[model samples]
Target chain A: MLIIGEKINSTRQRINRALISKDSHYIQQVAVDQVANGAQVLDVNCGINIKNEPELMSWLVRIVQEKVKVSLVIDSPNPDALEAGLKVHQGSAIVNSITAEKNRYEKILPLVKKYQAKVIALTIDEKGMPRTARERFDLAKKLVKVTAEHGIPAKDVYIDSLVHPVSTEPQQVTEFLEALRLIKTLPDVQTICGLSNVSFGLPNRSLLNATFVAMVLCSGLDAAIIDPTDKSIRSAIKAAEALLNRDQYCASYIAAHRESKL
Target chain B: MIDPKQIAENLINGQAPKVKELVEQALKDGLTPGQILKEGLIEGMNVVGTRFKANEFYIPEVLVAARAMHAGMDILKPLLAKSGDKPTVKFMIGTVKGDLHDIGKNLVGMMMEGAGFEVIDVGIDVSPEKFVEAVKEKKPHVVGMSALLTTTMPSIKTSIEALKSAGVRDKTKILIGGAPITENFAQEVGADGYAPDAASAVDKARELLQQR
Candidate 1:
């Protein structure tokens, strides 16, 4: 599975303080740790602190790239910050999101085309988040069509079958999985989600998240934005991969346990 | 005759508008408002609570079902009041100081409301003094606290200490929950009980009420 490390985001107090202090060592260590813990992509966000977003985005990209070889996912609500990160990133990056909203697509797609970056397409529109899998599927179809219109290939699009917390709605997980399954059926369109979303408002969040990860993987999730250093998620993903035969002969699982001294 | 059982079914299915209409129709059918309150809204929410505790239902399900039950309550509240009826228990809840996390608290609040308790939400980042002030003002039967961060978990004890000093500690049962909290921590903080989730929080609150 493709793991996008989510720990570097500034919403986390430590990361936020690190960013404010220009603590490159802390940021770099987090990036290195994520890569060491199996992150293939590092999701970089300046958090809700938007005052110096463009500068912080570039600084984060440069600092993380210095210590790690993984590609970056430029996560920002602002297109300018995303553009800043894309420009500073060493290789082609993944634009961490765009939605089915016309304004968002129009603003972000040109940058994707310019940067030649992979894109995470959220199945949402001006009407806000879709509550059902069918609605999400329809939005996914629209997203693919719109991205294709921008000359981006279907393979380059990662459909985020948005996972609302199951604690808030019992059927949200089922709907999200169903959307993911449907998205997988579309040729070359990959599926991804924020792994912790399933457990929000619930107790023992790690257990819920780990179990949901295994379940979504079975439902055809291609990647996830999550805390790569979380032991429960790490173990769950490795075990699920082995059980699903995605890890050939359990080599990855065995290697992981050996490396972690487990 | 509008069946109260159908009201329960509508609530389970999260049909708020239908539940509202059915509740009004039942009242029009000459049913006692108390009977509608007990057999319809409360019964429906009881099923939701049980399902939630069993993990058969999740947060969104409980929220919607509660809203449906509220719809039934809206029509019944005044009538039940005219008949001198009221939910016997009152719950006061909040996230502890330095903790902005309210989702867990909100869930517990919602579940408490669904289970026919009057819930007073004290909001997030509440200090010990603030909690004491609320206890003094609301005089709630139960005071529930939550904290998602380990950093803020100690505030639960602080709040409890404040309540004790205010002499209202014995007046209300204190319940604690959050990601970093355990039953042992709850006891350590001098809480009456600890709940693992929203559904269990309701059960725990009821148990505390019974003890009181």
Candidate 2:
């Protein structure tokens, strides 16, 4: 599974303080640690200060790339910040999201095409977040079709089924899993989710998150936006991958076990 | 022949219609609204809260059970008011300005209501001035603020300051919560209490109120 590191986002208090102070060392350390902990891609977001986001996004993109060789997921709702990060980003980055909302779709897609980058498309529209699996699937199909029309291949598009918190919406986890299964049927497209969202407003969040990771893996999730630093979640993914026969003869699992011992 | 235990069971299962029916039957069978509320609806919700804290009952189950409790309350409220059976605590809650997220706030409100607190939800994106105005007008025993984003969290402090300026700060206990809020932040903002989640919010509010 593709692991996108979610730790460097500015919504987190530590990251927000670090961003405001332009603490390159702190940002670089977090980037390096996420990569070390098994994040194949880092998602950098600096949306806390909307006015300074463009500068901060580019600065973060540069500092993180300097410390880590992996690609990034430039995360921002602001088009200017997306462009700013994309401009300085060394590798082909993934645009963290575009929705089915007409204004957002129009604004973000051109940047994806312009940068020749992968894109995460959320199953949302002008009407707001879809509540049912069928609604999410319908939006997923629409997103795939539109991105395809924009010359982006299905393989390059990542459909995020948008995991709502199970604490508030109990039936949503089932709906999200069903949406993942449906989204998988769309030829060559990948599926991703923000793993922590499912456990919001609940106790034992990491346990819930790890369990949800395994469940989503079973439902055909290809990537996850997650805190790679959490050992339980990392172990859960490895265990799930081994059980699903995705890890070649359980080689990854056995290697991970040995690595933990060291 | 109406049994409060049956009402509690129906409520625990989120059988709203059954709960309402049992409540009506219990009332007609000469039980006071207070007796039915304490033994039936609140009793069931207390179990729901415990299960929720234990992670056996999730948000949806609690929500439906709260809905069932509300169904029973709708029948008993008027009669309870006429009989001078008032809930001891009045709670006023709102999501702070520039943050529209309210699931946490709403959950806290529902849990408070289920716990027999008179909850006055001022809704989301509420300004500091608006909170001050509500606290003055509602004259609640406790004022709760919620902010889902780190950026919006500072508004909780601002609202508290507004309450102080409006001379209502001493009248109400200030309780703050949200995904981004912590006990340390609560202290930094001069809040009387902080809860990490809705279930705990009720406990924290009760603890704060008891300190007074």
The model with the greatest DockQ is: 2
Q: Hey, what RMSD does candidate 2 come out at? A: 5.4
Summarize candidate 2's per-residue lDDT along A45-106 as a digit string, tens digits: 88767568888899999999999999999998789999999999987999988988778888
After superposition, candidate 2 runs with Cα above 4 Å error: A201-203, B1-68, B81-102, B115-177, B181-212
Expressed as tens digits, the lDDT of each residue in B20-124 for candidate 2 is 999999999999999998889888988888888877887778889999999999999999999999898999999998666778888889889888899999998
Question: In order, how many clashes per candidate?
Answer: 5, 0
What ranges in model 1 sit over 4 Å off? B1-76, B80-212
Rounded to one decimal, what is candidate 1's iRMSD? Answer: 8.4
